[model samples]
Target: MADRLQGKVAVVTGAGNGIGEGCARLFAAEGAHVIGIDRAGADECCDLLDEGATGALFQRIGDRHGRIDILVNAAAFAVFDWTETLSYADWKATLSGELDIVFLATRAAWPWLKASGSASIINFASANARHALEGSPALAHCAGKGGVMAMTRQLAMEGAPHNIRANSIAPGFIKTQATARHLAADPAFAAQVLRKNMLQRLGEPDDIGWCAVWLASDEARYVTGADIPVDAGATAW
Candidate 1:
C-alpha cells in the first residue's frame, strides 16, 4: 500500500529529540520527505531560534523540494522559577524563542502551504498553559503557549480561504528527554505527575506523534484552530 504522506514535505522543529524527533521519524516513515530542525547536535538538528535560521530552512525547502505540506513547531525551552524570581533573559529565552521560530517558519512556508491546498501547521503547547503546576516557575512557558494557541486560531482563520489549517497540541507529562531530566531530579515528582493522569502512566513520544500524523493527514482535514490535548486525561480531573 502507498504511504499516507508519500508526496508531502514536512518541516519539524526541535527534531533532534523527544516528541519532535518522534514526529519527524514518523512523518518520514509515512513517506514524507522530512526536514528536521533543532538546536541540538544531531543528524537533523538546526538552531531554529537563531536569527535567519528558520527562514533559511524554509528557503532551502522551497528551492529544493518546491513545496511544504506540513510545518510542525515543536521547539521550546523553559526556566523554572517563581514569577518574581525569573530573570529577564530566561523569560525571553522561553517566550521569545518560541514566538520567533514559529512566526518565521510560518511566514517562510506560507506560500507553499497555500499552494498545497491542504497544508497543515501543528504548534506544540503544554498542558501547564491550562492548569497551574505547583512550585514550577512556568509563567513564561504558559504565556508563550497561550500565545501559540491564539496564533494557531488566528492563522486558521486567515488560512481557511486558502485551504491551509493550523492547530495546536498541548501535551502533559510526556516521557521525553526533557521530561526525563526533570524526572531524574525528583522521582517523587514524576510519580505524582503519573498519578494525576487518568491513565496513571507517563506518555510516550509516539503518543504525540500519532496525534500529529492525524492532524497533518487528510483524516483531519476539517480540524483547525483547535487545541487537542494528548494528556492521558490529565486535564479531565
Candidate 2:
C-alpha cells in the first residue's frame, strides 16, 4: 500500500486539479517523483493540445528523468451539447481535447516509456463511453471517451511487445470543479446521480485516483488492455 510506486517517474497531465491532482498527489506520496503537467495549476504548465509544445515538453521531461515509468493522460475539455444541436466545430474540438491530447502525449512519451522497459500508461475514459447519463448533454464527450477506450486497447497491444502496459479508467460522476457547475445549474442532478449510483453518493477524485495508483504500480503488471470502472457501481445496473 505504501510506496507502491517507489522511485518511479510519473507524468500526470491535467494535474492542475480534479482527479489528475488526486492521482499526482497520491503517486508522490507513494514515493514516485511525479511531474504534474497542465496549462495551469501544475508543476509543469503547458497546453497539451499544442503539438509542438507538448512534444518539446515531454522531450525535456524524458531527458531530465532518463525514463518515464508512468504516463497519466487526464487533461480534457468538452463542450457538452445535445446531438441535435451539436456543431461540427465543437465535435472536432472535443475530439481534439479528449482523444487527440491522449495520443499526442502518449506519442511524445513513447520513447521514454520504452526505455523504462516496464512503463504504464493510464488513460481517463468515462461512464459515458459505455452508457448515457439521462440529464447529461455529452454527445461529444461520449464519442471522445469511446475513442479513448478503443485506443487504449490498441496501445496495450502495441506496448505489449515493449513490456509497456496500457489501460484505462472509466470514472463516474465524481465531484470535481468541472462537475460543480452542472451540480449548481441543476439542483436535482446530484439526487438523480445518487439514485442511479449503487453507492448512493457522489464520488470524489480520490475514488478514481486510487485505481490509477494500482495501475501505475507493479501490482497490476498483469492488467494491461483492461478498462477499469471506478463509478461507484453507477454503471453496474
Candidate 3:
C-alpha cells in the first residue's frame, strides 16, 4: 500500500528495534510523518512506562502535528521462566512493561487521535495470549498480552463514536534480534516452532507492518476491537 498513509502523523513506540522499527520505517515509506520513539535509537527517546513522561511526549507531538493519525504500541517486556519459578516482582514488571506502557501512551494520545478525524491505534498482542508454546515458559507473556487484547477491545468500543478505531495484532515467532541467538543455537527449538505453524517458517516484521498499514489507512476503517492474527496459523489449529 504505497503512500497509503500519506499526510498522516504516526507515532510508533519501541521503534528502536524489531516490529516497531519495521512499522516506523514502513509508515514513513508510505508517506506518513512518523515519529519513532524508544528508550534508545529512535527519533525520540523516552520511557513510555512513565506516565508523566508519556503524556508530555504526546502533548509535544500534538503541538507539532496538530493531530495524531496513527499510533502503534509495539513496545513490550517479559522475563521468561517456568511458572513455578516466576517471582511476583517479575510478573509485576512484565505487566508494567507490556500493559501499562500501552495504556499510558494511548491515554496521552487519545485527545489528538479524536481530533485526527480518522485515527487508528494498533496495539501488539501475541499468539501466546491464544495458546502456550509447547516448550517455553510464558506465564507473564501470556498474561500481559491477554491484558493488551482486553484493553484494546475496550478502547475500540470507546473510540468508535469518535471515529478513532483501535485494534490488536498478534504476531507469530519472527526472526528478531531477541530470538536470533536462540534460533541459531537451538535447531530443535526452531524445528518445533516450524512444525506447529502451518506456514512452516517464521514471520517477518514487515508482515505485521503491512497489516498495520492497512489498519491505519482508510482501507480498514470498519475494523476495530478485533484481534487480527498474523501468526502463520500458530492459533489456527
Candidate 4:
C-alpha cells in the first residue's frame, strides 16, 4: 500500500484543512510529490477562481514536476440556506465556487495531465448531492455537488481518449470545522446525521482521503466516470 504513487505529482485544492489536507498528507505518505493549493496559507497560494492564475499555477507545477499525474478538486464554497432564503447573489457565488473552480482548474491542468501519459482526477462531491438531509438547509449545496458530478462525467468522457480518468467521491457527515458549526448550532443536526449513517459514528477526514488515495492509484484504472459514496451508508436508506 505504501508508495502507491511514487514519483507522481498531485495537485490538491483546499489543502489548508479538512479533507483536502487529509488527501495531501496521505498522498505524500504514499510517496507522491504533492502541491497543496488554497486561496491563502498552503504550499502555494493562488486564487483558482481566476482562470489566468489557475493556468499559471499549473504551468509552474508542470514545469517543476515535468508532468502532473493526479488532481483532487477538493475546494468548494458551500453555505447553508434554504431555497427561499438563498439569495440570487449567494446562489451564483455558490455555483461559481463549487463548479467553476473545478472547471477552471481541470482545464488548466489538461496539458500536464495528458503529459503524465495517464492521469487521474478526483472531484469531491457530497452525500447531500443525491440525498436531502432533514433540517439541513443546503439547497445550494445540493445543486453545487450535483453540478460537480455532471461535470465530472463530461470530463471523464473527454479524458478517456487521452488515458485520463475522472471520478468523484460523495462524502458523509465528517467532523470538520464546517460540520462543527452545524453541531454547535443545532444538537438535533448531529442526531439526525448519526441516525442516517448506519455506522453510528461520524467519519474522519482520513476516511475520504483514503478513498481518494485508491482512486488516484493505478488500482482503479478502470474506474472512470464513477461516483463513489464515502458516506457511512447514510444514503442507502
Better of 1 and 2 by TM-score: 2
Better of 2 and 3 by lDDT: 2
After superposing candidate 3 on the true structure, give the runs of residues whose Cα lies further than 4 Å from its correct spot: none
Q: For each of the candidates, give the backbone clash count.
A: 1, 0, 0, 0
The whole-model C-alpha lDDT of candidate 4 against the native structure comes to 0.92
Residue-by-residue lDDT tens digits, candidate 2, 1-237: 579999999999999999999999999999999999999989999989999999999999999999999999999999999989999999999999999999999999999999999999999999999999998899999999999999999999999999999999999999999999999999999998888889978999999999999999999999999999999898899
Best by lDDT: 2
- For each candidate in turn, the TM-score is 0.94, 0.99, 0.97, 0.98
- Model 2 TM: 0.99
**Order by TM-score, highest first:** 2, 4, 3, 1
Judge candidate 3 at residue 115 and give its lDDT: 94
Using TM-score as the measure, name the better of candidate 1 and candidate 4: 4
Best by TM-score: 2
Q: Where does candidate 4 have its weakest 10-residue lDDT segment?
A: 176-185
Question: Compared with the true structure, what per-residue lDDT tens digits does model 4 show for residues 26-111?
Answer: 99999999999998768999898999999999989999888899999998897679888889999999999999999999999999
Q: Poorest 10 consecutive residues of model 1 by lDDT?
A: 41-50
Stretches of candidate 4 off by over 4 Å are none
Off by over 4 Å in 2: none
Model 2: ten consecutive residues of lowest lDDT? 192-201
